[model samples]
Target: MSDLTGSTDINTANLPIIDYSRIEAFFFEKTAENVAENAKLLRAVNDVGFIYLKNHGITDEKMKQLFDYAKEFFSWPVSEKEKIESCESKFFHGWFSPERTSKTRIADQKEAFDIGDDSNLVRPNQWPADWPEFRTEMNYFFEKCHEIHLVLLGTFAETQGLPKDHFDSFVNEKDHFFRLLHYPATTPDSIGDRLRASPHTDYGTLTLLFNDNSGGLQIRGKDGQWLEVPPIPGYAIINIGDLLSRWFNGSLKSTEHRVVEPPPEWSKLDVEGRLPPRYALAWFGNPNRNAWIEPLSSCITAESPQRFEGVWAGKHVADRIAKLHKDGKAPEVWKDSMYREERPQQQQQQQHAQLPALA
Candidate 1:
């Protein structure tokens, strides 16, 4: 693996690369080669929390199609895309325009569409009426990512000395989210002090990120310097999230990361003097709503006592989502967001009556 470090970029670190084909082979039969690959995976996550996964099952054609779809969707006029604005959904599903979803003073210079499981009764997906293929293709990709999540989850469990199927029960209800993100091309004046994505740690267990290799993604190193994360073609960037860090009792890192403005040299300017836009897909793997998340016993020791109280996976995620909204609070009784508080009888009845058909 090549290190990102250069004389001018002395702070950058070289992140480990994991081969998913070997991980798959190890899942079936643990030969020495496969076992070594497994150990590399465990060490990478524990030390850096982010790694590039090559030979992952998703084909290049599929990824290209998804990116093409994202570009087409983002190219739509703002008014058309706003029809399914995420604010319209109780569970924060659907489209969010640029600058509308930020929690920081510097707004994120990107728009996104969030999709949850089709079978989620309260979190129904909102689709663009004009793009039927978008829905079909995205759902297909979503399922593919979920399959990878399961396999990775099994590997994590086995590496932690638990049964390979230990996390299987927790994900039975599939409380995951797949997001399509679009960062519009930028000019110096328009993007002054703004980032494509602000620094933040993800709230779920793992985040599988697919990018078009436009660069600008960076993770904060242990030494408190930002390290560039170069995108490698056909490799998905995988990172541990807060939930998994908690579950592992901080044994695994949940590194802070962000997407900075693309360097001017990376893309040519359009007629409008904007750099080329960036597109990416992020699949967040979360446990079921009721799954209890606590430090595993194996991760706890005298040197590192439990640092987190057990919390419901759904509630924890819901709370994080709420913080990004202007109100900084979610509905007290939103079942779809998985807030445990009970809703008033009349409200519950009305919402149930108007529930949309699952996508």
Candidate 2:
């Protein structure tokens, strides 16, 4: 997550709700209607920088199971939870307690657990042996999410006036990350740092978020107002990230967003249970670890030259973690800036084939 400088004012103007049912048509077809869809996508990225995506083909039941596993894991006693605490792990990829993680330079007061594919970036994901269903559901979800991100990349590439596979070479064996985050409920009077996560842009390419009914996610609109991203049933929220912004030469936004206290209307507190905690599963789509995340040459011009240096994707991730983890933790393996280079070339190739270039 990028801790971007932004505003806290509420936006009256609405964010767009997009239907992804036509994604197949747009990614696979070269027709005029598909052209229109591509334009629609570009508009969302330029204007709101985020969209409510429906007809994404993920089942509500599966998402619910994902939540069930999250709740179960978090319900364990402190000692039990300590068995897999992030501070104890070499890669900092396990459970991070509420008060021990900072986002906006302040303790986020929310808990999270991160998982990623086995890679040179760190190591194999650590799964709780007792939670077999958790591993199965999460792995399944990650694979499905990978498919979604590929289509998204194609649309973005096509819209940026590049071949549909313009970004394909850089995306092989991507370092996709899945995280389970929870912001526990507090009485209105007891609310401390109301922002669960402070305003920040993600360091990755695309961020797909699945949230429960309890709403608090907010994004800074172009007008300098923060717009509420209420949870829309059956819709998974999608937003561009800093990597995409550079690729599009900032014509597309890496919108700044944060989780803050929801207005009363958006709150789903129960009188008996008091305030109920909010749970969300975020899938962060990143590029290959060795790929240099520099601005695309096609996107640069006489007026807008490259704005950022090429950051090795793996180093960018480790650097970000070193800054945010309250305990300042990172695996010793992460000390080297270019560890991915040590891996064999063929191992870096993706199991999936590169997407075909658009004609």
Candidate 3:
């Protein structure tokens, strides 16, 4: 396995671009024509941990609408945007100013708004009150991304020699998150040594990311070098995450990646001599809160024994999220809330009675 720690350089790597139309066909039927395409996807992810997916069903017009909504939301006055700040929610589902997020000691230079499954009782989505259209459109886009996520999950299960529906039960509750990210224009000196987004691996099953052509994203290659991931219009960049890697016992990689300033040639400056702002949408796919995350039996072998102990999916993700906040802690309410299982009334009462007090 490649070392996960590294600093990024400007060298651009030629990443593969897979046509998802063929992969979609393979998902429905095992035809010879589309089989190779599926294999390409497996190879790309295993080798580089990232790939650009085209023809994935979401339209360019729809992507543009999402970007427009993000820009409008981020353009709101700081006070207005803070009305739904993440600090207000124990579940971290709301606006996060740049200062509130980081993967390292230096804070990131981007603001984000997070949306989770609306049906999640533990963390109902915190939507901007007045913008009904933003809510409507975001939900619409969220479902569209979920469709693609299902297809990819099925593909992964089949390719990994598990039943095609192996992951279905794990994701039935739709414990996922959608984020609107905006990296504001700023000069190099202003952000010295800091990045738009610090290097880190995602904490979920997989992530489907849509970005405007304004470039910045980079992925760490097996050679431990940072490779530029230029955005192709209408393409969603897909990558594995830590949970998926754990499930497969390191067979699929959850590579470290980050967003840096655009290359000099691609950099466009505004009147104040700052690079152009960049926007992106990311759909973070995760298993249900109650799901048990352990390596599939097939993934453990004589050569590669189980590398991780069993863990509850929700708690694992929540623990990682808590570290991103300034205080480095989740809300006290989150401790008892995330892993609660449904049960008979009497059993529920008994479980609650035995629970530990919140810190």
Candidate 4:
């Protein structure tokens, strides 16, 4: 059904690609005159669940600054990086170190850093006090994405034939997350699937990805093949997540993807000449802590009927992401079962204890 096999080596030339013009028209075009445009966009979302966005309105200069800062930050010594390692309460919502987990299906080949929302609102980012430019640029990039997230949410609501503000009411208190990922290449492991990132689906409303040209992003297509998502300058890869799919009654698909070790060509360079691993700036768009997510009356059908009831968007996403963080350093395992992780431990333990232990 939905492809989750997690293919590693991918051919980008033959993939089902979507450029910026199509995406721009999809978001900016009028409903009455350009109905076909909207339909095409939605159809893509339904089938592939991922699109390469072009002319998305985010600037190249801004992207450069963000990337520069990210590289600088990651280049810092391990001791310095540890200062911001996510605290227990912060969960996966803050800074994380490298080599935390062996690539999901393979050996230790990649390293990364991650940052997300502070549900408890207790963890402030560990800024490099000595580097004002780094701090300023990083924060700016984060804030900019947070703003773009609002617009994207509105666009999503419009796509569903709902009012522009449909998602606004539920997302007043947001739980969004911004992360910078680094994938360093290393020797291949047994299966050769050592992923800088494991195959998984995002847990929130949406994911906006700023991927570099060192391509490794792949999406599961309807053909049951893994399609490589090539990089588009100034374009963000947009995809629906699990919660959004349920909320839309499956109108949008949360395609599975992973980041694997680089191809042989890219991996062959001497240590000093090696092509640097991939860099991606990803944002997890979340709703307010108490936002209710339910299928709109128009999207619900007899066949789909209420696959998922109204869920508190913030609590739902936050709880699931936190558990994934708690389970391990990488976010892959967390995508396996949303329900079990979505519930808090206290409630889960109580539910388990209530079950017939003898059985």
Best prediction by lDDT? 1
Query: What tens digits encode model 2's per-residue C-alpha lDDT throughout 123-196?
Result: 56777767777888888888788788888888778755788787777777867788898888766554543457
Model 1, 191-307: lDDT tens digits are 667767777888878899998867778898888888877777888999998888889998888888888755544556789887778899999998876667899998889999988
Q: Could you give the candidate ranking by lDDT, starting with the highest?
A: 1, 3, 2, 4
RMSD of each: 5.4, 7.8, 6.0, 6.5
Error of 2 at 241 (Å): 1.2
In terms of lDDT, model 3 sits at: 0.77
> lDDT for every model?
0.78, 0.69, 0.77, 0.61
List, residue by residue over 166-202, the lDDT tens digit for candidate 4.
Answer: 7776655555767787766444452254456667778
Instruction: Look at candidate 3 and tell me the lDDT of residue 327.
Output: 39
Q: Whole-model lDDT, candidate 2?
A: 0.69
Q: How accurate is candidate 1 locally (lDDT)?
A: 0.78
Model 3 Cα shift for residue 270 (angstroms) = 2.6
Residue 280 in model 2: shift from native, Å? 0.5
